[model samples]
Target: MNFIRRLRVPRLNDKGKWVVCVTGGVLTCGFAYALEHTADASDFVVHPFQLPWSHGGLIDSLDMASVRRGYEVYKQVCAACHSMQYIRYRHFVNNFMSEDEAKAEAAESEVDFIDDKGVPAKRPGLLNDFLPSPYPNKKAAEAANNGAEPPDLSLMGWARDDGDNYVFHLLTGYGFDPPEGVLCEEGKAYNPYFPNGSVLAMPQQLFDEGIEYKDGTPATMSQQAKDVVTYLRWACEQWHDKRKQYAIKVYFGNFQFRTPPSFFLTQIMKKWSDFSFFLNYTLLPHGIQSVKKDYLF
Candidate 1:
């Protein structure tokens, strides 16, 4: 009780020491936050939306139906510009489609091949063929699209932060006119969702009813965005579902191996106790300093 009273009334000389400690702590925190906030953070604007496959950071794996729809979206719309250079038709066969269906899909396209006579010839795409690029080479691709090289999208979903969301927004967020003072070039389209608001070379891709959905799904802007993003996600990581399953098993296995039932019960309690003591030791002085600042100020 006496000690509590004494603490409530610190010696007058100690007040300056308390103020110095509190001021130093606040200045340290402020400096840390300032250091963390950087110019690149401006480019990280993400428009929030919900999707059927992901909810609140819990990804339910890519739905096969959505993947199929997204593939169609890519074929009909995105394939004209971007290429899925790393993907093969065989992936579809292994994951989503039957062998016959994959063959049929591949057959619709053609690939360049060397004939027995050592002459170049084009042949119908095969199950093992890479998804063909829109142009034969970088210069040709650039020439067709006003000197801009559309990125290969096989790994696009994994390439950027929130890549799924970024693709969706960039695809669908184009029709609006630029805000005042924003100048869109003559050929380029304005998309606020794009990192450069007015200078993106790729024009708007998704429009209402732009492509007929074979599955009878409505081809609205948002629907197309969802389907195409789903496809890109799958294209980028075909093993996403398998990876999750593997991860789950690995997590449990590690836990079991690390913690024999009898030892875990004892260790976890001690771990928590140590953690709590460390946390209080680290925070309690700062917390007291904060209260002193509030009261004294």
Candidate 2:
């Protein structure tokens, strides 16, 4: 019943296999040829350190509890300056909060719209209402932050390079004094992990005991940073795990998709006598050349 079952890839012949092999070789060569000869990072900037994220693996899913905690952190802390223009209050339903909680959350916020008289009016937020911005306009945002506007956070995660890792480090990287030869303006602070190690206008936002958690999790600086990063990751891709689940279902549907050595591999019943088509190159065979369980087990 799956769409992948309906996918009808023509049985490949020798000529077709050669074309695929040659095209793959050409693409591989072109990719290697385009490699940049550059340093690991910009001068004065520290490379983002990889953190062990619970949702980072290919098969792993988001930590909903962390996401809930992260929303709390953002509401109490980052929401003061930044705006999540793309996220709606109703997005929380069945994601981390229940429908009732989402409705309650929306009810707490007021939305601006035009009234029947064509006058501006305020109303309680709905599920479709976008999260409110901290400032009325870009100019106001910049003015309040000393001419630097806070960026919208809806696409912050999964949008930047090393997105989640970079954010986690930046939040906890503050409070360290500048190294030798570093200069900061009167109101700026240095964070080696961001802005190319430049002095930025934003100050340390997370601190120990800054806020209490509803779940009674410790309110440490690192804990807050990790939770917020996890939350932002979910905000970036709510259907991330759903996509993985779809792929898994494809293999379980239709006829037997595997051989002795291959798990979930769709092969042409023939063996070394004919070519085998797989994700790319064939790694296992069903006949004499069939791979051992190491290829499946």
Error of 2 at 105 (Å): 0.6
**lDDT, candidate 2, 1-297, per-residue tens:** 699899997899999999999999999987766653223224567878887898877678998999999999999999999999889988999999999999898888999999999999999989889988899999999998868898899989977899999999899988777777678877788998876545788999999989999999999999999999989988888898998787678766533544443642334345423433441255544343445334334
The model with the greatest lDDT is 2
lDDT of each: 0.80, 0.84
Per-residue lDDT, model 1, residue 17, is 87
**Candidate 2 lDDT trough over 10 residues, lowest sum:** 271-280
What candidate 1 gets wrong by more than 4 Å, as runs, is 1-59, 256-297
Give lDDT tens digits, candidate 1, residues 58-177: 336777887888899899888999899899999998677999999999999989889999999999999999999899899999998888999999999889767887777778776787
